[model samples]
Target: MSLVDLIARADERGLAASGLACLDRCVPLLGGDDEVLRPLWSSLADGGADGDAWGERLAKARAELDCADPSADTVPGLGPDPASGSGSGAETETEAETEAAVSDEDRAAALARRMLATAPGDPCASALRAWADACSAAALQIHRLLDVAADGDGPLVAAERRRQVAVLELLAGRGAGGLRPALEVSTEGRRVLRAVVSRRARGRS
Candidate 1:
């Protein structure tokens, strides 16, 4: 099924996991460690959306990551990175070239931060649906901003889209059992994002 259909059909746990997976994969942009979101995951495994653990963990994560509560548009109207289409992610050979590259990264980071900030403290089914949908959009955009393929989405964005689907499918098919594999899928994507961030930093330098 399409991602929209999968999300619409998902239960509370599935919805929460879907959104968390997206945010977890984008943690690299927030400069957070790999395990920063683990607590929230654990809360899910131990009944996250139904308790205070998710909220506490989310709060702690925001503080630890130093996610500033700034309004969106950190790069004002900085929309999709052209890299997702015909632009390239490897054009930073000088300060002048780095300007646009840095702006894309900054905007990507801003989107990531907003995902964390907007996550609901009470994670109800109603609230989680919106959060999940927003996370999906933000994560996809972040990947698009960082994507380097010359033709289309490139490997990075393509893989991210696939992983998002896989996470939802896992949750849909396996129920709670899917959480483990969904997390695993997200971890693999996180590693990919971290590598991209590292490569981009070196390239800009």
Candidate 2:
């Protein structure tokens, strides 16, 4: 079935998992640790997205991602922290160059942040449906912005859509057990994104 159909048919848990998986996979773009969302995943497994555990874990994940704690925002995967004020001499020049280099990734990260924020803590069918739809658009847009391919329907967009559908299908088919496979799918996408970021850096140099 198509991604939309699968999402429509999915229960509250499936919808939440699908959206969280997408955002978790894209966390690398936000300079987050690979396992930052692991706790959230555990929450989903333990009691789904509407429980106290999910809320606690979600907040913890956001804090770990530097979304909750502004002081920790160091721009690990994307680029230099924008708030780091201009330095003098060579340092300033280097910062300027880095800033220019990661503009696309930064934009992509912003979209990822939006996806994370849009996720419903107390997810019901209606809320999960809206969040899932928004996440789909955000994930696609992030891929489009980060894609190095020439303008058009490139492989990156196709791959992302396929990944999205695959995650939904896995959730629909396997229930909680499917979280592991869904996470594996996200890991593969993360690797692809890391490679894309590296390729962009190489092209820049």
- How well does model 1 score by local distance difference test? 0.83
Deviation in Å, model 2, residue 172 alpha carbon: 0.9
Tens-place lDDT digits, model 2, residues 1-205: 8878887888888888888878976887778878888888888888888899987787777777767642332342343333334323245566667767766677688768767765666677888887787678778877888775768647888899899999898888899988889988988998898788778878989
- Deviation of model 1 at 155, angstroms: 1.8
Question: lDDT (0-100) at residue 137 of candidate 1?
Answer: 80
Top TM-score prediction, candidate number: 1
RMSD of each: 6.5, 7.8
Q: What TM-score does candidate 1 get on C-alpha atoms?
A: 0.84
lDDT of 1 at 43: 91
* CA-lDDT, candidates in order: 0.83, 0.76
Error of 2 at 191 (Å): 1.1
Candidate 2 lDDT (Cα, whole model)? 0.76
